[model samples]
Target: MEYRSQGYKTKKCGQTVLSMITGKSVTEICKLLNKEESTSIIKDLKPFLESNGYDTSYKKVRTFEDIPNNSIVLLEFPDESLNGHFTLKVDNEFYDPSVGVISTYNKETRLPHSYLNFKKNPLKD
Candidate 1:
């Protein structure tokens, strides 16, 4: 996955992550989510992905080990609220929209709080 920067500070992370996953521009994602710029607490992400033929499952995680490889994860920054950050994880490497590629979650000083697992539905694909 390509790294995308959240240019609008904290508000754009969700849009940026959606862009990375769907190969859609943030503007397009915003339109799809019926927003002007940001996504509302990720409330629309699962439905949007499902509408696009992606099978998605979301759940809270207690530790990094609980996160499956190659998934979208919500990380909590030390100074941010729970599920305050969104990024992609593949093979233990993070593709953070706020930053860039990171080797580990600890390196970014973020805690993995939950994850969203998505795969293209075979029937839809």
Candidate 2:
């Protein structure tokens, strides 16, 4: 679903994730999607997705600390057993370059093709 955020910009899927990922307010996201009721569009969409064997829902925690920076690594893929493993890389240098392994069972090719570059906070020491 598409949504407006804070007035100046628009966000797609913003309404669904406003409560997630960002963990912040999404007043505009709610208005744009026109789903201000107790139930959410995401809830309706889950079953259709699951019926097709694509589990589009909450996942296990995959943190940025698991990977490194300026790296050309070929680690064993994630979300296997249900399918096969795939490769991932980090290009967004500002933060710790890490990506959550995409589930192959969710795709026909069983190959991963997307990313969410995250940074590492090393100074936690």
Candidate 3:
């Protein structure tokens, strides 16, 4: 999967997920969505993806076992000062768009984040 950083956008999590699903660059998505000074809103993202044929749902994953394989997950940090981050899970590997790094989910307690409880995929799946 392509990893796009949130960069200057407040909704980097949403933007990265959209980029992964739509195959669009972050800049292109910003322009396409007319997001000039801000970023895409998480709530607005659902309809857009749904219109494009992705079947999406959301949930707050309280435990490590709640995460599903081969899916894009919003990793929410407990700190309210920082915007939550996003990660993509492909099989056993996890990708962080912020740094474009891939790592294994080895049940590290320091993970410090849980799934945002949001889920979505192509309806045609």
RMSD for all candidates, in order, please: 2.3, 16.4, 4.2
Instruction: Give the per-residue lDDT digits (tens) of candidate 1, residues 1-125.
Output: 77888784557777787788889998888887877654533487777888888888888886877788657888788776643677887777878887798877663677777788888888986
Kindly list the per-residue Cα lDDT of model 2 for residues 25-45, writing each as its tens digit. 456435544555322223522
Candidate achieving higher TM-score, 1 or 2: 1
TM match of model 1 to true structure: 0.85
Q: Lowest summed lDDT over 10 consecutive residues: which window, candidate 2?
A: 94-103
Per-residue lDDT of model 3, residues 48-70, tens digit only: 66656566555556455567765
lDDT, residue 11, model 3:
53
Give me the displacement of residue 51 in model 2, in angstroms: 38
Q: If the candidates were sorted by their lDDT against the true structure, best first, what order would they fall in?
A: 1, 3, 2
Clashing pairs in 2: 95-119, 96-119, 96-120
Rank ordering of all candidates by TM-score, starting from the highest: 1, 3, 2
Instruction: Tell how far residue 60 is off in model 3, in angstroms.
Output: 1.5
Backbone clash pairs for candidate 1 read none
Give candidate 2 regions above 4 Å deviation: 1-11, 28-104, 109-111, 119-125
> Whose lDDT is higher: candidate 1's or candidate 2's?
1
Among residues 3 or more apart in sequence or in different chains, the pairs in candidate 3 whose N, CA or C atoms overlap within 3 Å are 54-122, 55-121, 55-123, 56-120, 57-119, 58-117, 58-118, 59-117, 59-118, 60-117
lDDT of 3: 0.56
